[model samples]
Target: MEISWLEQVNADVPLDDEWLSSGEQLILAGMKVPKRRADWRLGRWTAKRAVTAHLELSSHPKQLSAIEIRPAATGAPEVFLDHQSADISISLSHRDGTAVCAIVPSHGVVGCDLELVEPRSDAFISDYFTTEEQTLIAQSSQEQRDHLATILWSGKESALKALRTGLRVDTRTVSASISDGLDYAIQDEDRADASVIGVSRGWYPLHVRYEERQAFEGWWQCIGKLARTAVSVPAGGPPIRLSGCPRL
Candidate 1:
């Protein structure tokens, strides 16, 4: 897997039109809001970097503009090279001016999410979280509850991304548990302090899992405190070889 991240983006920074593929250019031109354009560009920039790195590592060197990341009909990201689809699954996330992309060598759907760890109101929790999840958050210490809520929220978002349904499917339908130590391998120097126990949707149990969920907790200077989770959703396909030594 190839994972890439960008801490900040200067929306005012000029974008070289030639650097973006035609499809990407179309998408860029359609964004009317400055912030939206910046966010979208940040995500695409990170994704392109990720794809370039992956291709180089795989011994399939390619130029940046030759690759394009676009949304599939299901809203999951798809990669295209020179107008032809590529054999890889891609996922993207952005929060608080930070963006990340995850690419896998197989068909297993992948999803990732990042969010700043902060306090959430009870009303927000009641509306978005499951009863069991709320109880767990409520039981945590005041200082820990914010982090816990962020983890739950991030995990669900990742899971939903893997499910390719986003938040359109009820968040409560997907649940994730976390531990206090590294359980997965993340590429960055930032170590993950937790692991996702399980992720499910409706009556169908998605065999999605993660070895680690990294919590910023003052470690990430650029984005302050944050939490991130990444998951792999199988599309009834054979398991792809995990690039990093992700211990479950």
Candidate 2:
């Protein structure tokens, strides 16, 4: 089945706590740092919106407040509705005031990440990436180096999230591969129609090899200066964007 995903910017999130569950509001109040608070709110708002849309529930503030997102022992977010656990899996990523959430069936596993396309030092790359990944970055043109590096790193993060290990595990244990002849500039209209049953248009195929044994199938895309990736265990079709989300 295709995983459903959604994206929301800072402006799309409400400034008030009315949409937040009581537990969530208490958690928000405990955050002291300004940026951390803002990022947490943005992530929660995005995740709630994605969950509501995926479950075909109402998006009203009262309804949203009934949905709670709490962290598990592993620090991964878990979804609860009216204090009951929801049977779904979701992964969230936020960067530069923008957040994305990917949802899959309860029995399925998924991980997603958003990263800014920027320069990384050789030491940074060598420290985290596998030798093959470092070689891929080294062979890329100077103009594409930053973007390539960002995509590679973002894919690793996604895979790590899927594994529920986050950065706790050695990143070098996973290797990412981008498709050949990828067109980063493909427009929404220029790509395949939404009715098509395959990888979405404008998104490129990506494969992540883990521990020289387990493999993950996923997709990646470049949106402006940001790189986004989603990986799943059983593999997923193109992401189905959830409609009716708020925008500002």
Candidate 3:
């Protein structure tokens, strides 16, 4: 199945539970507080605003309520909705003024992440990346680190979303190696680790795409990993070409 990607920045937005309760909300690190809402409220509301719009449900406010995130028996985020049954999986993330929500139809898991392009301090880098991942950064050029950080953050967050664990899992254990565009290679963990990461884990192809929100000036991206079992062929090979990869 083809993955869907959507991006938007709302000039007039007010973050509130009324807006957030409807759509699954994600809050990042930085965001300005709306007039009446508290600081924490705005962060989440802004995230909701972006997510609802991405879902193409902004036109109908009530539809946001249709998207719900209730804890599963395993304590992971599981989407439950009677809105429209196209079989959608959603992941929400936000930081500062930027937020992102990714939805994949009829897919077991999906993830989306957005990050402000900021330089990482040596200490911060050391804290976040594992020894192996640090080696990759040390070998990278200045330009590569600046750009790759986004991929690193996005890939990890996206993976967490698909895994439905959010940040409950150790960040360092999940590593995403993006040589180009965005694809994932789990560095810190093995196949068993992937299973604990979410309802459907292990190695699955991730589709990632991003756009810079001018208003938020943040990079928002979408990622998806297709889950399938009983493979006709060995794993780690090219996907079976049904017709063709669809244009998102």
Q: What is the TM-score of each predicted model, taking all chains together?
A: 0.72, 0.91, 0.54
Q: Evaluated with lDDT, which candidate comes out highest?
A: 2
TM-score of 3: 0.54
Off-target runs (Cα >4 Å) in candidate 3 are: 10-58, 65-78, 82-86, 181-248
Candidate 3 C-alpha lDDT tens digits along 1-248: 32333332333344444444433444322334553234334333333343454454543445445555554564444455454333555555544433334444544455556555457788877887656567867877775675456556556666555555667767775665544332232132133222234322232343322222101111222222211211111112222211111112
Cα lDDT, model 3, residue 100: 35
Compared with the true structure, the alpha-carbon lDDT of candidate 2 equals 0.84
lDDT per residue as tens, model 1, 143-186 = 56776687677877877787788978777777665544211211
Poorest stretch of ten by lDDT in candidate 1: 197-206
What is every candidate's alpha-carbon RMSD to the true fold?
Answer: 9.5, 4.0, 13.2
lDDT of 2 by residue, 127-205 (tens): 9999999989889888778878898899999999998889998999999988653335322324322224232445777
User: How do all the candidates rank in terms of TM-score, highest first?
Assistant: 2, 1, 3
User: Model 2 misses residue 131 by how many Å?
Assistant: 0.8
Error of 3 at 62 (Å): 3.9
Q: List the residue pairs that clash in candidate 1.
A: 183-211, 184-211, 184-212
Clashing pairs in 3: 22-64, 22-65, 28-94, 28-95, 30-96, 87-106
